[model samples]
Target: MSSSRGGVQPLMRAAELEKMSLEQLKAVKEQADIEVNLLQDSLNNIRTATGRLEVASTALHDLSLRPQGKKMLVPLTASLYVPGTLDDADNVLVDIGTGYFVEKTMAEGKDYCDRKINLLKSNFDQLIEVASKKKTVADEAGAILQAKLKQLSPSS
Candidate 1:
């Protein structure tokens, strides 16, 4: 039995070896808990980053593929105007591709895509940072447990 700090008997086997093994196990368990917490935080960060990327991707697609009303020109038919309509003939308009408005709209879309890409990259960076730290902590904790278990083994 272990020496009691008070007058009461310690709630453990009195053997020294058993006490040492119990202490080591307790330490290992604490380390395991810490490692688990770190890993969970890392996973949360990665999930957040993935969600942000998906949202950005969806927004980009929506903006780029948005339908601009019907582009077809109205059919040219004599019924569209009076048979002797000389004023309509003088006021007809033709389609000229690639105007200033189209260029401005395309430029806006490009800017939006670039911004979303940068945001996604930032989120991924944060995820990597957390994951790397978590991996390092988990590796160290695992090594400590392995070493402790080896020491406790009878064949060691």
Candidate 2:
């Protein structure tokens, strides 16, 4: 009987669902559907972030192995790259967030990426659990609604 995100009411028992009017059941189903969709979007974003962090971590490791002044192609945009040389492989710029970048040593940069990846993974797991519960609620509501409609049909 625990509360769900966005102040959604707890999942009701089948008896309670059976007592509700069609409109009320529909409202419950719609709300649960919306919440589940939102959670799914969040989960996707977290997954993308984790993937980017993993890439960053791998790049950092690769860079650490290269000597200073190594030739490289710096990406200016998705389709554009500029030739450049690694001036200081030991120090790299890390984008913390919100247009803020910080200079960190290679080890620190790798650590930061690992930490962010772990954090995003943790959030992803928790959100998955919530999304599953919300989906169950929506499915149950839809099932009950269908049953009610069937009972009221002329063929019944």
Candidate 3:
């Protein structure tokens, strides 16, 4: 659950929505749209994190296969790579987030990536459920608003 949505009120029921003024319905619809967008953004971020973790896991597997003193191009930046030789294939530095890195054995690094990927996947599944509910609420509110508008126009 996202802390950002802690202050948001629950969506009104369909029966209650019918009794709201035009302006009130519009407000509810807008709020629902905003909430849905936020949840979608959260889902996207989780997916990206999962992808990065999977890549790291693959890299760890590849590194474990290489012999010591193997020559390689170590990336200093996206486009900048410097020639280097493998120092310790058994041990690698793992980024634990918040600008921190911890040295761990290759097996341990792979395990960390797997754990993080699983955690992110679980969170993504939960967020998808929440986002689906929010979409339903938004759709219902929009339908009600359109009906109200049609009632006012009468010529359609």
Candidate 4:
């Protein structure tokens, strides 16, 4: 039967799907699942990076608002805080990766965060596009398997 929403359905018949071995169908499903999972992991990484960029952007903005020479609690470690004063609110230390830091003006730091956030979001969008294609393949394979199963049933 032709589906109301489409002009033509898939050409593969139930009989053709039934001819395919179960092992092959299962393999296709497994491979598709693995690819989708990897893409999801990458998306998670992008999300984490986005959060970090946002926090950095906010910190820079707050620093710019603070009066010069204002004493503040500086984080030396995750749990350790050191007494420090905001000597130059216009300057900031930006980590450029591999434990290397660059001293930049407040505006520069914000710009850096904006660039990183945009890059991460771009990666996230690309991953989503790829994952959607993988999911479509996985779904089609699943449909074939279901069709074959239905053919094997006595009710069919």
Error of 1 at 113 (Å): 0.8
lDDT of each: 0.46, 0.87, 0.84, 0.79
Extract clashing residue pairs from model 3.
none
User: How many clashing residue pairs, candidate 1?
Assistant: 1
The alpha-carbon lDDT assigned to residue 143 of candidate 1 equals 58
Clashing pairs in 1: 1-14
Q: Write the per-residue lDDT of candidate 3 for residues 1-156, one digit (tens) a residue.
A: 123555234445788778888888787778778988998999999998999899889989988999999999987776899999999999999999998999999989999999999999999999888778777777887899999999899593
Q: How close is candidate 2 to the true structure, as a TM-score?
A: 0.92
Evaluation by lDDT, superior candidate among 2 and 3: 2
TM-score of each: 0.38, 0.92, 0.90, 0.81
Count of clashes in candidate 2: 0
Residue-level lDDT tens digits of model 4 in 1-156 = 222433112233445434668776666666677777887999998899899889989989888999998999998976899999989988889999899999998999999999999999988998898788767766777888887778778992
Instruction: Give the residue spans of candidate 4 off by over 4 A.
Output: 1-20, 153-156
Candidate 1 per-residue C-alpha lDDT over 5-121 given as tens digits, one digit per residue, 9 for 90 to 100: 221121222242233454554553455446457656765765665565466446445444544442323334524633231222112232222542222343454455466557656
Model 2 stretches with alpha carbons more than 4 Å out: 1-6
| Model 2 residue 3 distance off true place after TM-score fit, in angstroms | 3.9
Candidate 4 vs. true structure, TM-score: 0.81
**Best-to-worst ranking by lDDT:** 2, 3, 4, 1
Q: What is the lDDT of residue 106 in candidate 2?
A: 92
Candidate 2's residue-wise lDDT over 98-125, tens digit each? 9899999999999999999999999999
